[model samples]
Target: MHLIIMRHGEAGWHTNDQQRELTETGRRDVADVAAHLAESPYRPRAIWCSPLLRAQQTAAIVAEVINCPIEEKSFITPDDDPGLCLDALLEQPPASPLLIVSHMPLVGALATLLVDAHRRGLPFMPGEAVVLDMPVVGPGCADMKTQFLP
Candidate 1:
């Protein structure tokens, strides 16, 4: 199984709440990312996204291109721990590819955790994604496959 972790696109911090929607640039960037995924060999079977507006919007666009159902997971919350989210995802492993649309620290932290279990950190840029191949029998056990940014 392949897990694709993506960070939400650029957002406006001057908005009402942290859940502020994505900017026009953000939308464009996500659209380009979606188009790339649509034409690429890697496609997601299921997509999990944070409830935040920005993250949801990004997932929605990607879903349109990939034609996959989106599952809103609270584990991607800003305050939520990435380790917990990773555990939950591993618990209910998807048969096909899985895409996760989330915020910075969580996305970054998840990538770092997958690459180096001892490292409790997230170092991902916005709109960046990391792909991992994992064994079905042994959950949480993954091998880094590829990483992409758009």
Candidate 2:
């Protein structure tokens, strides 16, 4: 299975973190990255997005460019457990690569959990993405394939 883990684009400040929205620059950056991904072999067939506004917006942009379906996931929020996310991913169909658009700590932690068997959060800039290839969805079972920075 191929997991394309992505951090949401830069977001403007909001009283509620879940309500934050992407900035103009964030939109542009994500668009550029999505365009490139659409033309690359790494384009995703489906997207799993965080319910948070910023993540949803990022997923929408990628879906528009790649013409794929997006499903909102409650387990991928910033503070959600990466282990739970992994378990949820195991329940998904593995016919094609899946793109996950989520927040900082979760995205980073998930990447490390899959690739290094640790929950230590890796640093990810806004609109950044990394591809991991896993024969089985388990801790440290995946190999980093490529990275995308918007």
Candidate 3:
């Protein structure tokens, strides 16, 4: 299985973080990432996203570019636990290639958990993505294939 963990694009400062929208630069950055993925071998079967406005927007752009379906997943919210997310994902894995659009530490932690469970997770800036090739959906069962940063 292939997993692509993506951080939402840069967003404006808002009193309500969950409602914050992507900035112009954020939109462009995500679009660039989408274009990059479009040319790559990756063809997403499904995209799971945090329900937060920015993440949902980012997932929409990626899904459109990749010609895949996108859905809001509660476990991917910024504050959710990476381990919980991993468990949920494993319970019902998507197709071979699954994309998750979410926030910083979640994306980074999830990536790390998939590839190297005992180590500290890598950091992900806005509009960054990490690709992993997993033999199975379990801890330390995968390898990082690439990291695409906007």
Candidate 4:
């Protein structure tokens, strides 16, 4: 299966953390990244995004390019555990690409959990996207297929 995990684009500080929206540059950067994904062979079949405003906005952009549906998942919040996320993913059918638009530390954690044999996490910037091919969900059981960073 192809698992694509991404961090939401740059967002400005707002009074409400969950209400924070993406900046202009964030929209553009995510669009560019999504466009590239649309042109590739790895477009996701489904997209799961955090319920936060920033993540939903980012997911919308990606959904447009990938022509896929988006589902808001509250458990994808920044501090959520990578194990739970993986379990959620495991509930899906096999052999389909899934895109998860979430936040930091969670994004990095999930990515590392898939590829890290040493329990060290990978770092990803805002608007960064990593694609992994995992036959199954397990630590160090996948390969990083591609990445887009800004």
Candidate 5:
């Protein structure tokens, strides 16, 4: 299965919680990424996103272009443990092509763990995404075939 992890677009920091909506540049960047993905050879079966405004908006834009369903999962919430979130996602049934829209540390940490089997966290830039091909064995134990960033 392919797991595509995406970081939300740039968000306004005016709000107290950083739940502010995406800025104009954020929208354009997300659109560019989504458009590129839509024209590419890869396509996701489904999209899952955090409920945060930025994440949700980014997911919506991609979903619109990809014509896929978007499911909100609480595990992607900000400040949530990336390991736990990875565990939860791995426990679920595999989707051939899955897209996960989430925040910085979680997405970065999950990618690091999946690639190296170590929990070293890396910071994913805003609107960046990584596509990983994981073995379909048991959950959280898959081998990585390849990874791409955009």
Candidate 6:
């Protein structure tokens, strides 16, 4: 399976974190990234997104370019556990590549855990995506293929 994990585009501050929306720059950046994916082999067949506004918006942009469907997942919230996210992924049927649009700490930590077998995270800029190739889902079972930086 190919797991494309991404951080949501830049968001404006809101009293409720879930209500924060992407700024204009964020939308443009996400569009650029998605456009790039349209021409790349890493284009996702579907999206797994956080329930937060910014993430949903980001997922929408990518889905527009990739022509894929999006599924909102509660376990991928910023503070959600990477191990649980991994478990959820494992439960998914193997078919097409998946793009996960999520928040900072969770995106980084989950990628780190899958690639390095550690919970420590790799840094990701807004709208950045890391592609991983894994035949099996487990700690240290995946290989980091490349990154899409918008």
- Each model's lDDT comes to 0.78, 0.91, 0.86, 0.86, 0.77, 0.91
lDDT of 6 by residue, 1-150 (tens): 888999999999965897999999999999999998888888899899999999999999999988999999899999999998889878866446889999989999999999999999999999999899989999999999989998
**Regarding lDDT, does 3 or 6 come out ahead?**
6
- Model 2 C-alpha lDDT per residue in residues 1-150, reported as the tens digit of each score: 889999999999955886999999999999988988888788999999999999999999999999999999899999999999999878766546899999989999999999999999899999998989998999999999998998
Clashes, model 1: 2
**Residues forming the 10-long window of minimal summed lDDT in candidate 6:** 88-97
Using all chains and alpha carbons, the TM-scores for the candidates as numbered come to 0.88, 0.96, 0.95, 0.94, 0.87, 0.96
The weakest ten consecutive residues by lDDT in model 1 span 134-143
Under the 3 Å rule for N, CA and C atoms, how many clashes does model 6 have? 0
- Count residue pairs with overlapping backbones in model 2: 0
How well does candidate 6 match the true structure in TM-score terms? 0.96
TM-score of candidate 3 against the unseen true structure: 0.95
- Of the two candidates 3 and 5, the one with more favorable TM-score, higher being better, is 3
Worst 10 residues of 5 by lDDT: 137-146
Backbone Cα, N, C clashes tallied per candidate: 2, 0, 0, 0, 0, 0
Q: Which regions of candidate 6 are displaced past 4 Å?
A: none
Candidate 1 lDDT, 28-68, residue by residue in tens: 88888878777766788889999999999989989998899
Q: Give lDDT: candidate 5, residue 150.
A: 41
Task: By TM-score, rank the candidates, best first.
Answer: 6, 2, 3, 4, 1, 5
